[model samples]
Target: MPLNFAHRGSLTEAPENTLPAFQKAIEHGAKAIELDVQLTKDNHLVVSHDHKFTRFNKNVTGLIKDYTWDEVRQIDVGSAFSEEFAGTNLPTLEDVLDICPHHLFLNIEIKNIPVIYDGIEQRLLDTLSHYNRTENVIVSSFDHVALKNVQNINPDIDLGMLFYYRMLNPWDYAANSGLAIRSLHPNQVYVNQTFVQESKRHGYEVYPFTVNDVNRYAELVDFGVDGVFSNEPGVFGS
Candidate 1:
């Protein structure tokens, strides 16, 4: 069977990336937990999908880059969802990693690899070294150069390149890089049997993004794409 990733840690029943979400994934027997990473002003790598904190606080509209880790921690990441989730916190990658046992692997997405997070590749390496999990990690990105940089830092760890839309030929880029494009994160609308066949034919795995509909989830699985990234992983599992 293709790997079943607990997208953002069983996010259907929990606030995405919260400890609750990750715990739910582990309990549900997911093999790996994938997450997004952003850097705080204090050089902390937080596991949030988007860099803006505004979703948590309407009045909070500044770039996360503008705040220190301490400042960012004071806000309520969960209350934005519901009062029940009010105390749910934004977690540092290290915070979550320490609690993860030997059974799990971390798929870390480098969300936007611009100058702000320039030294981030090295930082992630250092953090992974602390846990001795460099071998257990997979670094991925939409930015090919950043993926290349990550590969440069640690060639052995698996790397995946994310795609948003279909192009004339997507695998061409991944092949040119000399990087094994294990997965492609294309939009769900663009995924069909033809795309899946082409991806596999090219030796690439297809796992499209942000798909939550149960019927559509099954449709993709039937199409033979490897897996999916969803805000509601539990729904598909059903």
Candidate 2:
């Protein structure tokens, strides 16, 4: 069976990317969790999926980079999801590091596109080093340049490239990209049996994103994908 990564930390059970969601993922038996990281105005590393607060907080308007950590934390990120979770605050990357068990695999996607954070790769590496979480973690990004920066800073740190669109011979692309990539993460729609096999044949692990349907999950497993990102973590017993 392929590993199932809790997308945004068991997002169905709690507000996405909040501390409650992450804890719920652990309780739901998720061994792997994928979350997004963005830099705050004060340079604090925060856990959030959207650059703007529109999805989570209608009262708050602006990009995450527009506010300091203190201001970001003050906004209620959970009320939009549920009244029970009202007042739930956004969590910092360090906050997640403090809560999540060391044994769990972390796929931290850097939300750096459209609004790039200067030197975010190095800052992320520094934060991981401080938490002693230098291993068992894959830092992914849609911005290949940011990923290259990560590789330049620490070649030992594993890098995963995130792609939304289907590409021709992605494994060959990765091989020629000059970065020692650890894995490939594509939108689940683009994944196929040949894609999985070809990627693995080229010595790369394949993990597709945001797969919530059970039948689709089974199909991906049958296709020989290494893992999948899902909102329902416990559904596949991962």
Candidate 3:
């Protein structure tokens, strides 16, 4: 079956990236949970979609990389969205990993292209090594170097390439990189059945981004792609 991933959890119904949102997505029957990651001040991996935490309490300041996890935990992330999510603190990658269900796959995007996570790849590998989900996780990023770094650390895990927009030949990029792309994500206009077929021909899967409007989703489904990243994974098929 073609997979459906919730972009930043079921962001349509809950605060993006919070535990509540993730849990909501899982309950909604999403097969995969997609989220973004940034480095904390103390080198811990933080599960946040943005480079900074502007949506949180105004007391929180500075780049996310500049603050320790302890400091980050104090900030409230859900309040900006509404009182319902007022106490939502940013979750660490480990925090998220612990809560994720065994049946669903994970899609983690390394934010900030070219920013090295230092030992983050090994950290991720070490964490997954203990879990029964070695084959179920997929790491993705627009940062070719970052994805390549993760691949260098653990080749057993699958990796995908993410593109907010498309190029004439994304397959060439993946092919030249010496990694098998389990998935390729491109902008709507950049995608066509030809690229989808061509990517599949090269042994890669295609899953585009932010596709709303039922007709467009239907068309994308017709094009032979494997999945989609949508703001409302729960409502898509309903």
Candidate 4:
């Protein structure tokens, strides 16, 4: 069966990317979880989707890269999602790793697009090395250059390429890039049986993103995607 990953840990069930959401995803029976990460100004790895905080907090307007960990924690990220989750705070990558189930897989996406964080790959790798969990994680990014840096730094760490649009036979590109992409995370709109088969035939796993519809979920399975990044794991994974 395809691995069913909770996208940002069931964003519809709890605050996206928060610890509670990840926990809820576990409760929902997800064997894998995909989360976003970016370095804070102090170089601490923080879990958040956007560089800007305005989406989660109306009063706060700043980039996550511009704030320290202490400053980033001051905002209530969960209240925007629900009243019951009012005090929920953003989690660090270490925080999530500490709480994640040992049996589960983690897809830690590097949010290096638009705002490149120099030395982020090394810092991330160092942190993973400290925990000795590099084998259980897949580091992915939209920025292929940053991905290359990650590959150069640690050839053992698995890497995935995240892209939304067509790039002239993506599987071929990944196969020929010398980066040795273990997986390809493409937008759900462009996935089909041919794409999935071609990808696997070339030794790349196809994990399409943000699939929520039950019917579409069935289609993806029939199309033979290795896995899907889903907002509701219980709905699709079940």
> Model 3, 1-238: lDDT tens per residue?
6786888888877789888888888888888888888888787778887777775666667778888999888888898888988888888888887888887778888786545567666666676777766778888888877777778887777898887765768888888888767888887666888989998998898888877766787888899989888886643333
Over the stretch 131-169, how does candidate 1's per-residue lDDT look in tens digits? 888876678888877787777887776788888767877
- lDDT digits (tens) for residues 83-116 of candidate 2: 9999999999999999999998999999988899
TM-score attained by model 2: 0.97
The deviation in Å at residue 224 for candidate 1 is 2.1
RMSD of each: 2.1, 1.0, 1.7, 1.1
Query: Which candidate order results from sorting by lDDT in descending order?
Result: 2, 4, 3, 1
Q: What TM-score does prediction 3 earn?
A: 0.93
Best first by TM-score, ranked: 2, 4, 3, 1
Q: Candidate 4: where is the Cα deviation over 4 Å?
A: none
Q: Which candidate model has the greater TM-score, 1 or 4?
A: 4
Q: How big is the positional error of residue 187 in model 4, measured in Å on the Cα after superposition?
A: 0.5
What's the CA error at residue 94 for candidate 4, in Å?
0.7
Top of the candidates by TM-score: 2
Q: Predict model 3's lDDT versus the native.
A: 0.80
Compute each candidate's TM-score over C-alphas.
0.90, 0.97, 0.93, 0.97
Model 3 alpha-carbon miss at residue 143, Å: 0.8
